[model samples]
Target: MFNLDQAISAWRRQLAAGGIKTPEVLDELESHLRDDVEQQVRSGTSEEQAFNSATQQIGQTNVLKVEFNKVGLAKWWQLPIKLKGMLIRILGREQPFPFPDLNTFTPRGLQTLELAREEAPRLGHDFIGTEHVLLGLMKSEDGIVLKVLRKAGVDNSAIKAEIERFVGVGPVHEANMAIPYTPRARKALHLAAREANALNHVHISTGHIFLGLLLENEGVAGHVLRNLGVQTETTREAILKDLAGS
Candidate 1:
């Protein structure tokens, strides 16, 4: 008389709270649970016994959280959007940048994102944020973003060394794991497109991304840049100066 479907649904709810929210992982777990239940039942175990055995074999919630932490699927979606937007505006001393679909990243701009993905794990962070993007830009070595940051006294080695000191060793990112962007990072990207469009530029370039980071000034990336004396207006002017010369 055990309701297997109900039990599974309840288990799923519990799993989600423990950070096992990815549909792919949860679905596979449920499938395996069903198979385990069937096998146990056929071996003369009662329905409830089969269910308990399957649940036990599926592992505890804390263990699953540890196992899946590398996938970078944690609880960042819990942030309050309205408050976040307000804070972003206040921190930057300007209105929040309107959302823009920034689809055009120059080859190097695209490469910057790839570099960000790499930096996220190295920093032991579960999510890719504006800080990671900034780190990525810094890691580029010879790109325009790096050059600008360097010119402004934002020392790469110093920043990297300092930021690492502040953050503790966290979740180890798994290979090929899909990492979700933090809200501010996503907002920064959209603002990058806005920066391009505002300047009548055809392509979203790395310079525009710098503008995005500046505009989305509430994120950790903005904070780090500010600490380095990279104010938004000043950085924007520098980018404009570069754009004008080029």
Candidate 2:
């Protein structure tokens, strides 16, 4: 008479040993197992039988471990909450900003730079700044910022639409030369860098960048984000919670 709870507990230990290190992943698998078990019990199966069958259907631990391993291909994708912490510890060494390099930027931070560059011209802005960078953050699929925005009932398309309504159209810039960051936009990015450092974070991420924009409350990006119903404090708190949960 094997105990169902014991069986599940043992299964979890096996998965952990096999390198399914994400608790969320294990939680989801457990959820699936429980669902299967419940269905079996409803059909009059014994609890032990339900547990056994559910475990088997969930598959061998090694196979599932292999599947979970793919999610860690990029170092940042594995544990986003530790992205800054981990990178700052590379080669058994660490450096603070001014000593830090561009290598300290998360993938989404780099993407934000690109998006800001491209979006400036599209929106008829002559320079990249907090507003443009904020828009860029929305374009990223990998960033935590997008998740928060989506949860807030906002998306890139919706934001662009709102911006279009607010700013109408202006003279499109030629792609030959680069436009510069407005003074406020430059200050926003500087603030973003400071924000990351204040958290003792090694890398600048999309969340930090978003926070930077909010900190620049007098900038165009801040105004736009506000119009879109993203309160700085509310979204910042949401981002912190997401990171903690991760």
Query: In model 1, where do residues sit more than 4 Å from their true spots?
Result: 1-103
lDDT of each: 0.70, 0.67
Least well predicted 10-residue stretch by lDDT in candidate 1: 77-86
Give the winner by TM-score: 1
Task: Tell me the RMSD of model 2 versus the true structure.
Answer: 18.7
44-141, model 2: which lDDT tens digit per residue? 99888898888876678886665445432422212321121122122112212232245777887888777888887776554454667877888775
Number of the top-ranking candidate, with lDDT as the measure: 1
**Candidate 2 regions off by >4 Å?**
1-103, 244-246
